[model samples]
Target: MAANAISPVAARWIRAWLILLGLLVYATILVGGATRLTDSGLSITEWQPVKGALPPLDEASWLAEFDKYRETTQYKLQNHGMSLAEFQFIYWWEWGHRQLGRFIGLVAVIGLAVFAARRWLGGGLGWKLLGLVALGGLQGAIGWWMVASGMGDTDRVSVAPYRLMTHFSLALLILCVITWLWLSLRGAPRAAAPEGRRTSILLLALVFMQMAAGALVAGLDAGRSYNDWPLMAGELVPSHYIQGDLGIRSLFEGRAATQFNHRVLAYVLWGLSLWAAWRYWGGALARPFAVLAALVSAQALWGILTLLNAAPLTLALVHQGLGVIVTLAAVYLVWRAAAPATPSPVQE
Candidate 1:
């Protein structure tokens, strides 16, 4: 082994640590989806990174927290006359989401510190790990920003759609990066296929765009509208595709427009995935493309079901979780497709 190389055992330890952290991040995303679905995101009303770790302990503390939430536009306009018990319900959800985030940060920092202290992280891997930690911190800030949008003096009853999209998009981006790093540590590069690599990259990009589109749909509660298949409101395009005065912004803000966009992107992604699967069948990229095609098909179907059912909590979360899985699959394909034709020197 080279002087700077990380031992196989050390690499495995680092990989295991990353895998655990990745799973936590994945859970956090799901919890966030649940928070949105249940309208619990704005319940906390404050971003106390340290002091906020502990939820309201007694009735007075709980009421104090609830009192703060009562001032938000969402509580005033939407949840007016809500009971204290009901308040606790939403508060707990938001509190859990934030607590989970803090836990992830703790685990990430501690793992990096331990690995670095033991000199297990070599070949600049320590810096990469540190960068992920930094992104995690940024994500926490973005979460608070998203929550703040609803608490402001506006007619909005929930977080701004664009900010929600931004926060969700960043979470997925971090997940992709973590996945790519984990895949890199697997060792033994496969022979690269340029054509397949290009296709894989295209598919990954489409999947990511579709996720962002889905976020907009969730943000605007668009899936609850036009609950029909093949056609929205019995037309190829809804008559009110751009209902709001937001004009071009309607694509992201308008319920009809956002849902329409999400549906269109899903169709495009589904077709592209199937095509890639067929094109790469019996080739080096066959398995990954096949898995991608299957996942895309399932995701599209679930999405439709989610729409038809008015985006129920259970189905919506499942759809969102499956989307993450599909994304990880795409990341894996990209990593595999981009491998060097010959093995490269292994580093930690």
Candidate 2:
């Protein structure tokens, strides 16, 4: 190996570290989804990067926290009569979510430091890891911004749908980057078909867009109302898909509109996945595309079941988890499709 080249052992260690960090990020996302589902996002009402790590230690501290929450629009308008016990329930959920974020940041920082100290992050990998840390910091801020929307002096009982969308989208973006970095660390790459590469990129983009749409659905609690699939409320489209005067904003603010959009995009993505798989069939990219298609099918079906059940915590979390898996798979396919093709063995 060249004197300046990265050690193979170091590369393997970095890959393992990234995989661990990716799983932590995945867990944080799931906890975040649970927090939103339980209406626990607004429970904290304050963002303390350091001090907030310690939850209420005694009854007085708990009361102080609960009192602050009581002043929020969510409590004032929606949970006006919530008891202390109920407040504790939601408080713990939000706390756990934030705790997970803190732990992930700690792990990332420590891992980066160790790799840098050993001079193992060669080939500009250190800069990439730094960028990830910076993104994580920004995500934490965006998280607070999302929560603040509901805490302000407004009638909203939940965070702004678009802000929530932004936060969720960024988390997935981080996860995708980690996955890409991990794949890049694997042994020498194989050549990719240009057409297949393009198709995979398009599929990944659509999948991301669908995820953003799903976040909107979650932010607006849209899935709970459109319980019936194939048709919403016995009609191909909900009668109230468009609100009276909201215009373009209705798509994000109106439950019917958000749910309808999510459904339409899911259908489009599912069809595209199948088409892409068939296009690349019998080729080097066949397996990944086929797996992508299968995951899409299962996700679409699970999404419908979640809707029919009014987005219960368990089913909704499973749907969200599956979405993450699909996204990772798409990321893998994209990576695989971009590698240089390996030369065939020389014929006799």
Candidate 3:
């Protein structure tokens, strides 16, 4: 704990690479979310691992792909007569998403090699990063599967809600792993959840679950049409949304209730975090609680702004990005609370 910098040892190099890898992966997920919202996820029909690398080299290839896109419900019913120029707009977004995925994989491989060569990773630590890399690879497959769901669906031009949720959940899970690893390398074992800190951890988990729920809401376009806030259609529950679909639309298919519930949960999360901070100011985890409370407030405001603006791409991305951040702060706080506490100095 000296003022001078710690020497850049082999361990430090591995930690840096791991931290960068984590950030790169999270960035890819953020871009992927933007791709979905822009209706660009299904631009290319085929999932080519090697061939997809090279984009259309000629006009004929471009037109061929455009024609294929035109055959789908997204282009036919949703984006009818969209110019080839405009088509390129969405195509690039989806392509960027794929390209980033490929880049991250390559970086992770190189980074892992460096770690292994230096003997910085061993005794299952290396395997954990390897496992994350494997997850990243599987994520590519999952990404394609989700895109395929929308390619030929009669009523939908987007992926299934559950698929979207799974995709996001995996990304969040990976981010958490990266975070835990980063903290561990920094020699910060989380302080144990204080006598009352377990409750805070539970609250944080609840907040994260709500974020996953919000993704479902966004996937269904529930936020776009639902302009009313504070209440749904001037009622507490908006009975019609829950009953209108009548047993069928209770899950992913339900739009009205999806947006409504997301709104309601935002309030709940905001209240819970704020109250925790207020009540626990003098407690063991006060700092993180306060940070979470602040983040939740900003996120709530962003949610309202996104909804009011009809979920425009810019505002919507910000809204979703902040939600993740708020969730992350909650996670970090909870982890900190659960970390083993430091002991006092020897008196004898």
lDDT of 1 at 24: 95
TM-score of each: 0.97, 0.96, 0.90
Better of 1 and 2 by lDDT: 2
Residue-level lDDT of model 2, residues 1-348, one tens digit each, is 544456768878988999999999999999999999999999998899999999999999999999999999899889999999999999999999999999999999999999999988766678889999889999999999999888777899999999999999999999999998887767555566666888899999999999999999999998899698789999998888888888789988899899998999999999999998898899988999999999999999999999999999999999999999999999999988885433211111
The true-versus-predicted C-alpha distance at residue 153 of model 1, in Å, is 1.5
- Candidate 2 at 204: error in angstroms? 0.2
True-structure RMSD, every candidate: 1.5, 3.5, 4.4
lDDT of 3 at 18: 74
Q: Give the winner by TM-score: 2 or 3.
A: 2
What tens digits encode model 3's per-residue C-alpha lDDT throughout 237-326? 777675554466665568777787777787788888888888888877788889989988998888888887788888988887777777
Best by TM-score: 1
TM-score of 1: 0.97
What digit string (tens of lDDT, one per residue) describes model 1 on residues 53-114? 98888999988988898888888889999999999899888999999999999999999999
Candidate 2 residue pairs in clash (backbone atoms < 3 Å): 190-340, 190-341, 191-340, 191-341
